[model samples]
Target: MLFLLILFLGGPAVLTSGRVWPLYGTPRKTVTLSSYGGHVFQEEGVWNYSTMLLREDMDVLILGARETIFALDLNNITNKKAMVKWEVIPDTQEICSLKGKTKETECQNYIRILHKMSDGRMYVCGTNAFNPTCDYMSYTHGNLSLESKHLEGKGKCPFDPFQRSTSEFVDGELYSATTLNFLGSEPVMMRSLNDSIRTEFSRSWLSEPSFIGMKHVAEGQKNPEGDDDKIYLFFSEAGLEYDSYKKMDVSRVARVCKGDLGGQRTLQKKWTSFLKARLDCPVSQTKLPFLIQDVFLYCPGDWSTCVFYGVFTPQTDMLQYSAVCTYRIQDIRDVFSKSKFKAMDSSSSRWVTYNGDVPEPRPGACINNNARQKKFFKSLDLPDKTLQFVKDKLLMDQAVEPSSKEPLLVKKGAAFTSIVVASTTALDGSIHQVMFIGTASGSVLKAVNYDEETVITEEVQLFAHSVPVKILRLSTTMGQLYAGSDVAAVQMPLSSCDHYTSCMDCVLARDPFCGWDLISNSCVAINSIQPDTHSEVVQSLRDGKASRCPAVESSTTIKFFYPGNMVSLLCEPGSNLAQVQWHVNGHPVENSNVYQIQHNTLLILKASDSDTGHYNCTSVETIKGVDYMTQSATYELRLGDFMTDPSVQPLVQEHQNTLLALKVLVIILTLMLLALVAWNFYKGYFAIPKCFNSDEESQQKTSGCQKPLQTGGRNSAASKACSSNSNNNHNRLSGNQHNGDQVF
Candidate 1:
């Protein structure tokens, strides 16, 4: 009876007035798939794959678990498809193996970075198993294994993956990001792609061990005629502190011409170099107090032109806050030619921080490079066109702020580990850059800017519970976006779910891990609560030792029907220690005449049309230590059903009115007929009796009848007289009949 009552009241159709359909159920299975590279992976350790990149032919480079590296193929995997195709421990295993190292079956060797070199070979870098090393391998199409001629060099491989380095192919030379430490130290702005080539021009202004960070700024950019002969390298020094950010310090942007990648071994003027001033960011500097972890350059459009974007944060805040910053490819290059360096005295140089550095023309610095050009100035690089250094700010805010127009804070923050940008065309036919930010909190937030501004036009939260996002990347084919945190690697198709309009913080506050789009509105998965129809044994026998649930007693999550939608509830399952009360905002969901409980579930039948708010499923549990109360996943309840568009609601009302009018008319007609019958019966019993024939008239009537029978002449005359009297009596009766008739 209890179950029946709950079902009757809280069924999706009943509660919602037949609006929304419930779409979530108990998760069938949560498998922590193998990490890219690991020794002994715990069942829960599948969340560790954080760094990712796409190789040629849809192969993915995944970095995780100490020195482990796995290349996976993501062509055929989804919630519905339960299969994975991957190649484990690429051919660099020989270089990763350490001699005399105590091996404990634990995955010790892990691949940190994978970079494709100029010679069509792959350079794989390990942070360090026993000792950090770079392994070089040549890749062949359709083959999974690395075809290496030999392990020619140990640690001298010129390609470094972790440092902020950019590479390009110029003439016959390759340039890359190189640094002092295995991870990073003093930075080498740019270098030849191959370790064997040592050119004179390569060692001059661009020569420095990569300690800070470096990347290719104008790679693949072509002149108007479309010749891609030249490339630009953006380099910065490391260990430099920011105005108010982190301990680590770095410059904004510098350039090394590929024309300088290969030259003579020794020369006064080796690699041609140009230095650009640092960008000015205002809002993020005050909020985020950390330094940048990395930078990535994106070529978002068909034109060879590019934009340099980086991830930044503050150093002090315990909870890391970060931002993403963007600059145009032309702005940095123009800075060098725009400003002239004033000579500094020896004593003045020691006192002045950037004494030798040049300044912009005038009104030089704007958050975005919107400063106007001066009427006249001298530029050594472009003498004809006066040099003017200007800054162009694209986006701001650690995550995309829905309202702010500043550039993203391209610095590291608490709970944040990695950032990557995916460039794609939106439904509007316009190009957009989707940024995936991984936080230390173990959650991933995807942000994209629309309206030609930096504010996050849309933000969606991924992951059920908070888990740090360690690394993220987009596929070359623009097919999918992959994210890696500490424990699991998640794959999201380019257009999988609806674009989330609300920010993650807003979703978290309401505890509605699920949302329905108000526009092309549909119920979407914000948590791991999926749509499963397998009808688990637990759904029947509530406490009969059925299959174990997928969630822990304190944080288990389930999806149930409420009104017009599937409400995902994160709560403790099966434990009935105390009153299990459901609340919206802070109001309790009480059991009254319409409230019901079933299988440890609460259902509200005839859910009020106005009860839309955040619903919380709260349960109090007392263990050995103390009493504790926990709330399930927050559900943001929006009124009405996506299935029942409001445009048709009025038609139903009109149909109902027509039926009511017909019923009222039938009742009125029946009452009138009953009254007429009662009146006729009263007249027959009272008024008609009063008009009964008198004794004389009765006698005359009888006599008339008898006279007609008499045969004699005397009786015939008497019969004639009686007939006249009888005729009078008959006339009176006919007259009375007219008066007594009742009209209906």
Candidate 2:
């Protein structure tokens, strides 16, 4: 009875089964710059989105193009009125062309710097036709307009639009690290306080530096005697301390005191507290090390706990691969404060650590109360010897390693151009950080950082064309992402919850913003939850645990033929990480002539009566050291005699039976027609005589009449008399025959 119940409930089994289809990542929404009227065109030059800034308070995003700036509203990106465009003047074009620059390509203004000031205005800078320029932008009454006032942006901006540079606004001043000349041969790190206190041209300061970014690090409030606000600049420059034999480009992280003023006498209007250190990002197995490409600062709460995420690539092939590493703010401070300074010893002709007599106050220390009370109030009070020592001793002897020791992400096939990170709480209430990396192919990859490893959650195509994404900005307050490419700027939501329909898909996505809502039976963004409403939501971004998902019951069944029949069972596992297993009659499958496994399918060759049983396919996955198993629909296989069993009969057998019946009917009709012909011949209905053959009786009677005729001569009288007697006998015979006929 139990077997019959299992058979009835399990239903018929299928001949072929395999794993389920996998789900690919896609974007939920995408808005291009053209949709918001932010795209601009130039007849002689090309325009590209090179820089981006997000304004969470006003719900608008700012994008920088070649000679143009666009402001797009985040709420309605398609509205034309919600966007604004501002273009720089073309007065420097002829001057740049006369200086041997390409008019159609390089001799055009390219907006590079867009720093928001503490006031309501913004400081904008551009490479105006190979002559760097800066201007003030005012945003009042919800309208962005450029001011007529302009400043010489020599050290504060790069003359070439394609040159890499970075700038930051600190204490109503702009500190930038960029090339200062039109030829792009001179690189300098300058402090622009009304453009008078900038660094003078000197080889000891900066040697062809390609700056990535500048970050402002403030002192911790808990430490009363801690350092002042320090502005750190990350870049790569040509190593000058070493000779030509050992000359190579080295990655560096330099820091400057925000309170530093110009020196008193000899080194006037120069940075008196400038220092730098080496940043190492080497390959583990090869000599190809990672060159710094870009950097982003993530400060969650405290300055000491801040992290710096940097993108690096090899110089050999720019389009092949890239890597991302993280550095803690404390580690950087340690390298800057405790590491020894590198100096060139002329006598030895080699670079070595400084071991000379030290000054009373540190050369690169910020001006504090002790120095102020001693009449050393500012950088101007510092001596020329101390300033010169700091100028030549910028590079640190020790190198700073990344916090993770290894890269957080190593992307292949496409080079990474920009990166931004965000954090979210998982179901376990633990914070998880997710990194959004932009590629040169105009795609954004979302990766989650877990305890064991980093898992790529999804990839989104941000642009219709394969243009490089130059800038990426994330708004954690609004949960939106802004990407800028050469062709256009795009805005999209960070989490695409609608793409994940089921609990399994939502959990496996590993996206902290997505959760499976039990009340609605759909995946939804956690940020969309109402403040007062309460609902059952499950998020497993860290561990990808799907224990809360409801069990799925399947009722589908399949059946196949028996005896020398081949059968294949398909079981869809749904996930690429899952392993498929086959079970027959509630027992695990074994390799034999009757059963063969092919990927997610089970093949049975020459099926017999013993092979008849229930078959099931299960998928097993291991996530965070825990096993998860899911079973597919049950299938029942039955074997019976091909000749007698109706269940095992095929449709072709019915056709064969009909053909056999037609042959039998034809044979019966032919036999009946032959019997009718034989009966007609027996009854002489088609013949002329009743006797069909002449026998010896008739021949003997003819011979007897001839013998009397031959003796006729001697018996002529006898013949005549016999004739008379015969006539009488004939009459008597006729009378007897007539009587016999009458009696009958």
Best by lDDT: 2
For residues 1-744, could you state the per-residue lDDT of candidate 2 as single tens digits?
233223323221111113121221222223343332232222234368777766666666666787677666765444322324444356668778888888987887788998888776778888888878888886567677888567888988899888899988877888998887878887877888564455557665677778888999886355456457888899887766544443356677888888777788856777777777777664433242457878889988878778999887765552355677899988987887677777888898767788776564666777765666667877888877777777777667777777976676665656778888888865556787888888777777787777746767766777654787788888888777777777777777777777665676677667788888888889887767654433488777667788998865654575756688788778877455667878887899978867888888889988887878899887766667876664466777766556655554665688899999999999999999999999998898876432323464344342232224345566776656656765787789899999999999
Alpha-carbon RMSD, each predicted model: 27.9, 20.8
TM-score of each: 0.46, 0.71
Alpha-carbon lDDT of model 1: 0.40
lDDT per residue as tens, model 1, 1-744:
233224334321111112121111111111121221111222233324543446644354433334344555555323211112122253333343344333432224434545665566566544343344445544344333444333322222222322333344344444544443333333443443353332222221233433233454433344442222233433333322121232232334444444332222222122323333434332321432234455666776643466666665544445334656666655554554344332223554311133233333221221111221332211122211112211111111112111223444332323445566776532222455666665665444445544432322222344435565556666756466676655555665543323322222122111122333323234343332233512221111111121222222323222223463333333443232234657767777665755555544655555555555666665544322333343344555555553453434566777789899989999999999888888888788534332135665455444345434446698878767767877898899898887778531
Q: Candidate 2, which segments miss by more than 4 Å at Cα?
A: 1-46, 82-91, 193-195, 199-204, 220-223, 240-247, 318-321, 373-375, 527-535, 552-621, 627-744
Q: For model 1, what is the alpha-carbon lDDT of residue 303?
A: 36
Model 1 alpha-carbon miss at residue 97, Å: 14
Model 1 weakest lDDT span, ten residues long? 21-30
* True-structure RMSD for candidate 2: 20.8
